[model samples]
Target: MKAKLRQLFRAVPDTWKTSATIRSLLFIVLGLLIYLPIMSDVLPKTFDLNVNTVSGVTLTAPVTVEDTEATEQARAKAVRDMRPVYARNDAVTVHQLKLVNFVFKKVTDLQGQTETTPDAKLKDLKESSPFALPGDTMPALLAMPAASLTAAAQETNKVVTAVMQKGIDQNVAREEIQQQVNQQLVLADLDSRTRKIVREIAIASIVPNVTIDEEATNALKETVRRSVKPTMIYKGEVLVEKGQYISEQVYHRLDAAGLLERNASYLPFFGLAMCAGFFVLFLAFYLSQAHRDVYWDNSKILLLSSIICLTIIVMKITSMGKGINFFLPGYAVPIALGSMLIAILLDTQLAVICSVLFAFISGIVFNYESLLPVDFRYVLYGFVTGVAGAYSLGKATKRTRILQAGFLVAIINVLTIVALYLLLSSSTGWRDVLNQSVFGILSGMLAAILAIGFLPLFEGIFGILSPMRLIELSNPNQPLMRRLLMETPGTYHHSMMVANLSEAACEAVGADGLLARVGAYYHDVGKMKRPHFFVENQINRDNPHDTLAPGLSKRIIIAHVEDGVKMLKEYNIPKQIIDFAQQHHGTTLLKFFYHKASQLSETPVSEEEYRYPGPKAQTRETAIVGICDSAEAAVRSLASPTPERIEQLVRRIIADRLEDGQFNECDLTMQELERVTKSICETLQGFFHNRIEYPDDKQVAVKQA
Candidate 1:
């Protein structure tokens, strides 16, 4: 039972996921809506409008009274206005219809309002009962009403009922004429033709001419089919109820209004909303990434961020098919933004792992719907390309380097795009393929550029110190380290030794050897300001501590650490190195001086006076440095160095560190500590190995120094 409970608990996130849960929920909810348009049948077979060239006061007269040549005359006039609408390059084609988000649904629940007016603007623009509030704006982009819409097309009877009862606006007649002339007919020179038919219609209405009516009816159908729309519609809706006929001229009117666009009649705003949702997710992920401290450092956020990236790619694919993509791109923006910090401040491989997961998750998230094979090569190539660029650029301190690396990645992306395009699609025309190839390479480069540009934002946000930063600091020629080498060569050499030991110990426990090495190099910089006070630089021979009392000697000795921090601050040492320098000694006692103080005093000497003022080690690297520093010093004092003696000394130092609570807050465990001791002993033993004496007896002593 306990094991089961532990397993259940272990499966839970180590950190809270308030934001992740919200985003995941958002993805699932929106995905369902996007996919719903694929299966419904009551959708319109086509979006071609039938009502065109609405003549002056062209009213939907009651069907109860239509037995005359006037109807025939109307049909004739319809033909003349229409021929130009379908004529190629005539500029009078009916395809120039608009489908702006602004809606004007013809449906009214109670049929007619009896007052001719525009539609009510719908707050829910994509709903089945599409309507536009008088004040609301329409979609800016025009839609070609096509055969694909079934859902909204089925509502024609309902639409006709609303139209006949409510008597749609007189202004609608004028707007219809204006839309044709301004949007289509005028440019096609149908301006003159439309006018002629209207004049003839006026003559026919007054005279009741049969031939003219037939010509006019044909003209209207031709004139309104200027636009075409292809739709993915929903199931079972009233496409054209009991009282409608295709020849009733309602299709013409619907097409002109954009309601005739196949599936659009049911969900007018679907595509636009998909695009908008994508933008929303983009912005959300961007804002989420903004909290670098919370998202960049936490492993869960890093993992989930990849998931978010892939989901967006999938959403973009499913939202509008393959038509909307640019070139192959990755979560390079987030991954690169987080990489340097993770590499420099955390761990290199973890950063690499984060990037790897980001690439693969994109495949899972991009849910394609067609039977046609999905081309994931772009995503795959982009991931490989992006991760490569991120790791390459992550080591840099200069912002420009990030961009430079990104540019290179962009080139790789383009190649991948071209190659993948070829493999996925069999079209081999270089003229056609060249553009894609050029674009693909450029896109990859752009992703890198974007990543580079975004790096500073995250760096500043997270306070990340990169590898380049650490390396810049590790240079012995740097001002502070140089000063140490010049003013106190002995202390500098001592630091080198500590760095060697620390680096070895750190490697034993799988910590970054570079950081440990770098930290050890600057750990004793404070001793530089007062070289004579430390034993290493006291070469000319008088011991400064010999002239002083034990307590004063301890004070002087402890003061070096404070002085070093101040000097480092003046020279601007980075905080990590300063931490290692200060914390490595911790509050460890100065046994030699403390014992002297105790021997001389009538009252007992307090341990506080002899201890180094320090914060305990906060990281494994710093704790390893502390142990190594003590062990190195203690080993130097060993009377006869041997493998066992060195091992004993290293163990005692680590044991003492544990006992003193030096590692209380650090993550170093007993197992890791033991490994560190073994490594240090192995290193020291090799360095101080005993050799067999030569029979010549002129053998040199082992190089103990």
Candidate 2:
């Protein structure tokens, strides 16, 4: 059943492939999926209650909106509360002081006039004064002695100068200025009449030296108004409880938010669509430029899209919960699950990119208040945990590694949660911290569990040869591996040696070393079908191939490729591994059989008949594997092999394959081939290094004597 399904997927038509039309449609569907969850928060929920009427149900804000009435009231209060600014005029103080001096100087001049009567002097004093004085007070100023009058004038100047310097504006009333003058006069040494006269003169002289600065006062009020933030009806915040009366303020907020009317604005939806479109375009651009292999393969693209959609859906579901106690349910969203799976089943670099995308999506999905376009707390948590998950699962070869990756993610999640709480929250308590930590741990563990459960399904459905699957196939206990080990131990040993050589060479040339190693492990599985015919497994037995005719031997030798391919297919192995078994020989001639047939037969033996069916190495991995397979066998056959001989033999094998057009299909460069040659030679030297020969006991005794 699985085999048939695999065949069906392989035979899918070009219409279903990643053409422009299909790609666009897939991206459109992904964008819609993203937009739908976001739209749920913005879509208005209307109420029927009027102001002063009781609400039937508790009404929570669907989206965050400004409470305009409350905001305006707050602004008005801020303006009222602000104190008016004032500016002082030095010229006003200077002129007022001059008038006070003139009044005192005139009083002195009247006292010194001998030609004038007391009435005349009083009249002169009154006429000369800058400000009005009482008729009774003027008579005392006219009769006063020069020294006493001079003290009064000096004291009046002191009082007026002190009061004027303190900046009296229009806000300061006449009575307040009189009270202030009286307080200063308490310390003056003037007689009652003289004090009264000085007080009247000083009060009149002290005009408002400070006036309101209209520009400065207006600017201060503006600053205060701007500082007062608008009152917001936060999303999910209760506007009115069930059976609660709807106040005028509440009604106005509801109406302003479009929750009291049917005609809601579609701008939120349009904005969300734009955001989703941007995310889709970014993903498309990234895949096209950085991971073209996944971009071109429609199946891989589908797999990636499915993972992203599933992860977002999980986050959305988790975010909908009202949180356990003080714990944020967003902490338990398992955001790292998608990244870990992508890292294991796809490219690690692509997984890192998806981690960032998931982080941003999580920010939007988990924004409970909808106050900000994205809640940065969730963004930070998602990014740190996702990156930790991806990096922790680096080249994972064991199923348990996923769990380990999850554990690491959990640790990071806990730290991230604690850090965010400490850094972003104003009043986080111990209970809240503990609850978030627990949820964070649960998120990591859940991500691991989900990734583990989904891995096999993805590999089977999409025929993805993940590192874990490759390692599983490489295990000695696997059925095919066991059969090779027991039935043809010699071939199994040769396969292991080739695996080591190929893995090193492939890695040296920046190819998939794990894939190459796993491929080499199963490359010679067909030899188990005719163990004795192969010289390696013919221990203590006759070489069956030596007894058969050249044509028959050629058929047996060539049959392994077909037989290995058939066995691998029956076992439902991935096509990549199967390619290794099929393409390792790459139509290379069986020289011994072809030469034998040429020498014995009257008719010339055709080279094509002796060669394996040709579909030469079609990838760098296959090409490197084939080269190492030949080099390992050839080097093992050499007697007393040296480093120089090994290097010479490895270079010759690569040169022959290059000249014979075996590597023509693959994109292996001359520089890379040289690296492969060096790597193989180095690996073979390690395998066949000279060892110390210890002397026997009798020889050692003879030498000692």
TM-score of 2: 0.75
| Local accuracy by lDDT, each model | 0.53, 0.86
Score candidate 2 by lDDT. 0.86
TM-score of 1: 0.51
- Which regions in candidate 1 have their CA more than 4 angstroms from the true location? 1-384, 388-412, 423-428, 443-461, 690-705
Residue 432: error of model 1 in Å?
3.9
